[model samples]
Target: MSCLLEVTALCKTYRKQHGLFRQETIKALENISFQLHAGKTLAIVGETGSGKSTLAKVLVGIEQPDQGEIRLAGKVVTMTNYRKYNHVIRYLFQDAERALNPSQKIGDMLTDVLRFSTVLDNLQRQQKVLESLQQVGLMDEHIDFYPHMFSAGQQQRIALARALILDPKLLILDEALTVLDPTLRAQIVNLLLELQQQKGLAYLLISKNLRLVRHISDHCIVMQHGQVVESGPTEQLLTQPQHAHTRKLMGMS
Candidate 1:
């Protein structure tokens, strides 16, 4: 598969306040680089504060990297022009419920996304929204429900439906399954895999869960202190981790 997204020499830093008139420069990401191909899964596994979320933010245009190159479909992309990429590359957050509008119906949520992202009129948008709902195994009637009414898994499905509405070439799953139970997590994992096969969708999965990485990702990168210390095929990296941090993360140490 040809690469859909390529990131090179990515670096980001932040000024974190420690005390009055005292601020510390923290490196959120350092020379991070990776690529994702069509229909492939790339897992970013690391401990908290390891810059995994930072990387995701950069990719989705929420955070701008001070130094780096981000190329989508072999074209350069900067934060200024990033909104144009949203339809092709969508970002999904960890907290599914919070990602949705508490006051909005499911249909409204989906419709709102469609309205902002596409040129479809109301009748056309509604048809697409219903199609998206069905694609995620949601009934059309459930579209009238609110976020609080669905099960955790169904909420995720609703989010998934919204992400799929644009038929994005890539979906960035930033700790997206962290809140679910094991069974629901597994179900979402399977749903993601199935969606990849069905839609030729690529994924950048951000999580600390090695088991989730092993189950869904084709390739994996392990980060520590804002740098990638180890990376390879998911099974090999998990089974024979080369970096100490990777071993410790996999509980091998």
Candidate 2:
């Protein structure tokens, strides 16, 4: 498995104002570094304000890093060139419903990506949409339904379908399974695993759920106050966390 994504010395910050004269510099990420290979899963676990979401945003090009390097498929990724890499990397947010358009039918929503990003004709784009739906275990009939017409799990499947429509090498999942019920979560986990095996997809999972992280991730990184406090193979790190923050996060302290 080749290195699908590499991030090094990544840093991000924000400025906040208090009163009229005082300003605060918030460190959202600091010296973050990691690598993810094709068909592998890497989990980022941290409490709120730990910079997990900021890292995801940076990787997906929603936010730019103040400093650091991001390489996708061995090519440097920057704000100026991120558009060229969009088809190779995709993001799956926690809120599938909110991420989707309520007005557009499923097929239209999926087709829109192809329409704007590729040179596929109408018939070719339709075929690609149908293929994407099938990949996510959706039937062709469901393509005509609106977002509200589907259950939460199905809506998520639709979101996954759209993400997969581009055949991306990496998928950044930011608390993507947090809202689902236990049963649905398990189902989606299984589906995601299947898809990864079939598509050779690399996953960068952001979550606060230790159990979920342990179950799904091959490796794990624990973040606190914008830094990676501890990291290792998932099973080993969960059972034998070295950092105080990691132990506290796992309820081991």
Root-mean-square deviation (CA) per prediction: 1.1, 0.8
**Global fold similarity of model 1 (TM-score):** 0.97
| Candidate 1 positional error at 20, Å | 4.3
Error at 248, model 2, angstroms: 0.6
Clashes of 1: 0
Off by over 4 Å in 2: none
Kindly list the per-residue Cα lDDT of model 2 for residues 118-151, writing each as its tens digit. Answer: 9999999999999999888899998899999999
How many residue-pair clashes does candidate 2 contain? 0
lDDT of candidate 1 over 194-213, digit per residue (tens):
88999899999998877888
Best by TM-score: 2
Model 1, residue 89: displacement in angstroms? 1.5
Task: Show pairs that collide, candidate 2.
Answer: none
- Judging by lDDT against the true structure, name the best candidate: 2
Candidate 1 lDDT score at position 228: 96
